[model samples]
Target: MDITPVANPALDPVQFPRLEEVEYLPVSTKYRGMRLALWGGVQLLVLAICLTPYLIYKFGGEESMATMSAWYWPVGIQAVFSLLWFLEEWKGFPRRGYAVRERDITYRTGWLFRSTTTVPFGMIQHSELSQGPVSRKLGLNHLKLFTAGGSGNLRIAGLEDDEAQALRAIIEARTRR
Candidate 1:
């Protein structure tokens, strides 16, 4: 049996559709609120933990004022960090979006270091929908797609429950074919 090498041809890049040109749909508006709430809750929890030592020192009737003063540093640092984190989430909310094409699903995120991920239906092994307690209360769901080799798994968060269901169904149908 003789195997003949086929001629390799150069394709024009201009003919292909640009990802930037795709009209991505913004995630649910409630997503921003949900994220903010979640972040606030986490920050509060950490702040409470950090303050425990100081609270113990104060309540235990310790005489060392310096020890209690040192605890303020952690709390102050956390306040600054939390402020920046909240600001990033608020400002970057607009940048999170997704686009579903006939062949693939794309999710774009990030404000400073932007990232876009595309997963073709052919490569998707399965898709799942998940919701955290806060997201569930906010009527939001996260769609996660697992690829064949486990390398291209993608999670698109902040989708409305209905939208996530529809996308999952579409992916299920396409993968069946």
Candidate 2:
């Protein structure tokens, strides 16, 4: 995929106008931040679990507990490394985002290894918006664009209902073929 930055700084703040057919799409920073926060929290929990042994041993006594405590530091360090991996994945997400432009539907998605597959309007079998607990809490919904391909479905998350439904209708109408 040929990835190019917009030379025009004006479009930097808002949407970057589609120039030509590109391989990948750009991701929103807001989503990136959320993912980072979520993963970081997870990492913190893992770290805590690893440190519990030592805290228990240190607070408890030298009575048959210090031996278990020796494993704590190693586990904590492993958790830190695991967290780093997650952070790397989160960071790479933005770069994996992509936009699809064709005679059918125009779709965009995140940069990380996510499902941003686009189906031409004609390929769409049906469309709908679904909300999970996390999504509803965040006032976000996922618009699923289904095609005959079944397993290779395309979904756009973090969209308002109006926009999702509108896009769904448009695709359904256009791709009635």
- lDDT leader: 1
lDDT of 2 by residue, 100-177 (tens): 455554444333443435566666778788987765666656777787879757776656556556666666667765
Error of 2 at 141 (Å): 1.8
Q: What TM-score, to 2 decimals, does candidate 2 have? A: 0.61
Q: For residues 1-177, could you state the per-residue lDDT of candidate 1 as single tens digits?
A: 999999999999999999999999999999888778778999999999999999999999884879988999999999999988877787777989999899999999877557899999999998889988888988999999999999899999988988889989988998996
Query: Candidate 1, which ten residues in sequence have the lowest lDDT sum?
Result: 84-93
Off by over 4 Å in 2: 1-20, 23-28, 63-82, 96-100, 104-116
Please give the distance, in angstroms, between residue 113's alpha carbon in candidate 2 and its true position after superposition.
Answer: 5.2
Q: Give per-residue lDDT, candidate 1, residue 148.
A: 92
Candidate lDDT (C-alpha), each: 0.90, 0.62
TM per candidate comes to 0.84, 0.61
Q: Which residue pairs does candidate 2 place in steric collision?
A: 25-97, 25-98, 93-112, 96-111, 97-110, 97-111
Candidate 1 residue-wise lDDT at 25: 92
Output the number of the TM-score-best candidate. 1
Model 2 residue 42 lDDT?
Answer: 82
